[model samples]
Target chain A: MKNHVQWESSLFELIRRTSVDLPCDIEQGLRRACKTEKKSSRARWILEALLENVQKARDNDAPLCQDTGSLIFYFQVPVGFDTNALASATRLAVARATRLGYLRQNTIDSVSGSACATNVAYGAPTFYFEQCARGTVDVRLLMKGGGCENVGKQYSLPAESLGAGRDLEGVRRCVLDAVVSAQGNGCAPGILGVCIGGDRATGYECSKSQFLRKLDDKSPVKILARLEDRLLKESKVLEIGPMGLGGNTALLGLKIGSMSRVPASFFVTVSYMCWAFRRRGAVLTVRGGFKKWLY
Target chain B: MALLKPRRLEYPFTPEQVGSLRAGQFVLVSGLVYTARDRIHKYFFDGGKSPVDLKNAALYHCGPVVIRKDSDWVVRAAGPTTSIREEPYLPRIIKDHGVRVIIGKGSMGKVTEGACKAGGCVYLHAVGGAAQVLAEKVVSVKGLYFGEEFGLAEAMWVLELKDFPAIVAIDSKGHNLLRRVKSASLRMGRKLMKSSDPFIP
Candidate 1:
């Protein structure tokens, strides 16, 4: 258990590196989009500036974006693993990471609006702990920026009107409407996660969970899979393309999740993520000794 | 002799003038324009009193970067903030104050479109995040309507600008370039998504 706790602290340092660090995958995505959407000079310039900013951030060990964002942690723990000491270690690691990462203290007291320079706060590292069948601890850390966070929306619509059961087309419409409402404000060429069915809170949780998935993976559910296809199709038709300067790509990808809903109510929620997808994850193991796998 | 500038540069600009201005176009403005955002809009709409007269004036959608010295305010970075944040109150502000030009980034909603057409005003989009560059164009910091208590980012600081660069996004004829661009791009994106291989197989 002591060994496991030590591994957790090491994982936090790695997460901090990835949070402010510009990973190669995100850089590749931005570059590919820039080449594909060459017609938009302004969009190209914005992307180039962002790319330059990323490099500068890495070189100087500065935050990649000004909004350091709230720290969100998703933990998938083994069912039988002792988890009592994990919280205290995580808090210490977060405080240490804030100093190491050079991340701005963005969390403000809601009432007084005074910023807590240290990242650690009451109930922060906003843990969503899940006991999984898998025999290892997997933690994903996301620095979700405020610009894209402002655009998240959830709504419950009548089930009968759209389709008999949950229609994929109706889900697609809802996602499209969300993107349109966002305009360029969410800083377009953004990504979105949608969850269909479930109550409001659970639906949002499912949507956010989708962010932890690998950028390359596709949706698992067939209905949601088809909805992802349709949403990608319809959203680009919005012309809210890259940075809202108007281009071929408005959204990078649409990931969807689903759960069964009651016949009376159909709830849908969409969580928009900006181009600055600042997140990283890692797995730590102490079976024989401390080992870390950064993702 | 130099050419005479238009004298009656007030609210309800002519349709012809609006059509000429494109997104990213630069124009030298020489007239009265007020400044307001979330706080001031709320103050007037939320039934609070105002010190300045808003009639026949343009309300810039900006919260300026300013420095103060001996009671005088100096403009530092006066770029437009995202306009869509004030979408709910913009139409009412335009109607109530007879605002002519709305300078900000992003596009407005349907209500603003109707208001622009009905009130004969235009929505201009200033380049976002170009604060330091935009501040160079402001010749003087006319006066501030609101205090710094509202936060430097949200307070309404009146500015007198010259040659402020902007593109006419939504014009009096109800034409919005932002929407047009979005629709066109969306059509292209839809086509590309449908094909199994967007590129040649």
Candidate 2:
């Protein structure tokens, strides 16, 4: 069995990099959004400030945002790998990261509404473990903040109000409604990960997992790919702009996927991410050393 | 029209001073501000007594990132939390605490706007997700209340700020930028949806 300490160290580096660095694709998306706005617009300036903050955080090795958010680790391991040992290592890494100030102490007990200083609340640092046939392990990390999480919405389709059914067009309308409601609330010029079908909980789960995809990647399904592009454009046309100040760019990216659902339920779930899209990945060597960083 | 510069606001200000501020204008706040989140607002609205006097103070809807240094706490990153979460409690907090300004990210609701007008307060919007930039303006951590019980995010942190930057989103006159944007965006959304021009093709 691989030493748990090595896995813990790998997780620490992953958390640190995820906190400090804004991925190139997201940065590029912001740049493209910036160009579409006028020179004197608040949207433009907000993007500029965001870009500068990204650089400053990298230089200073500080937390990107005050709310480091819930640490979600997605792991793909070989069939024979020690799953329990890996889970323990991840928890230890999260605790170490919090103590080292790479992550903020953010977990809370929903019942008592009290802080769990260690950030290892019962359901927090959400883990998704997938066993693969390959020998190596792959880990992807996404830090989802509460502000954006609050704006996430799930819609039951075949609604008369939006003229939406269970089709791709229905998904289009549902996603737009979410964007409009969000306004500047979820921190505008955000990224959206949408799941077109599934039950309520799984829809949200599947939607959040889409954040692991690269910002520029299009859905493999031709129709879903087109919908992604359409949503991105419609989001820009809303004039909610950045911080709802009004401008040409309102959304940075849109990612959509579908899941088989029961006939009665046609759930479309959307997960909103603020401009600070903190996600990163790493491929680990057999000994648990970082083989390479994935953006 | 020229861009509105950030008006300087210090603590112990009058309602008229706050009333004079308009929505869409920027402001630089200096002096003492207290940090409070959803829990603390609930505490105040639930008839909890104030541990410290809050008259004419600026209340920031922020859950700051702080670390223990030697014996005291040092603020590493401090940014505004979503203000809408505290909507139900804001009006009462403004009235009961004599709060001159409510600072946070995003915008509050009609209740908050009405409260700002009636109670003589303004809502300020700090740039969301810009924690490191905002932390630079926090000169010192003056003190903390309920830190042990509420934890770092929910605690009432007394902070000394120097030229803290924010935009006036909801003014005392009931001029709410957020409200205006909502209506405008709703109209725009309808118009764009009508085109059916296949934005992607």
Across residues A189-292, which tens digit of lDDT does each residue of candidate 1 receive?
Answer: 77788888888788988888887766656777665566677667667556666657666567777788887777887888899877767778777663412256
TM-score of each: 0.66, 0.96
DockQ of each: 0.13, 0.58
lDDT of 2 at B167: 78
Candidate 1 residue spans exceeding 4 A from truth: A1-12, A80-84, A99-101, A133-135, A159-165, A287-294, B1-22, B25-83, B86-201
Docking class of 1: incorrect
Judge candidate 1 at residue A268 and give its lDDT: 87
* Residue pairs in candidate 2 whose N, alpha carbon or C atoms collide under 3 angstroms: none
- List the lowest-lDDT window of 10 residues for candidate 1 chain A: A158-167
The local distance difference test score of each candidate is 0.65, 0.85
Residue-level lDDT tens digits of model 2 in B22-89? 89887788999999998899999998988888998989999988888999888777888998889999
Best by lDDT: 2
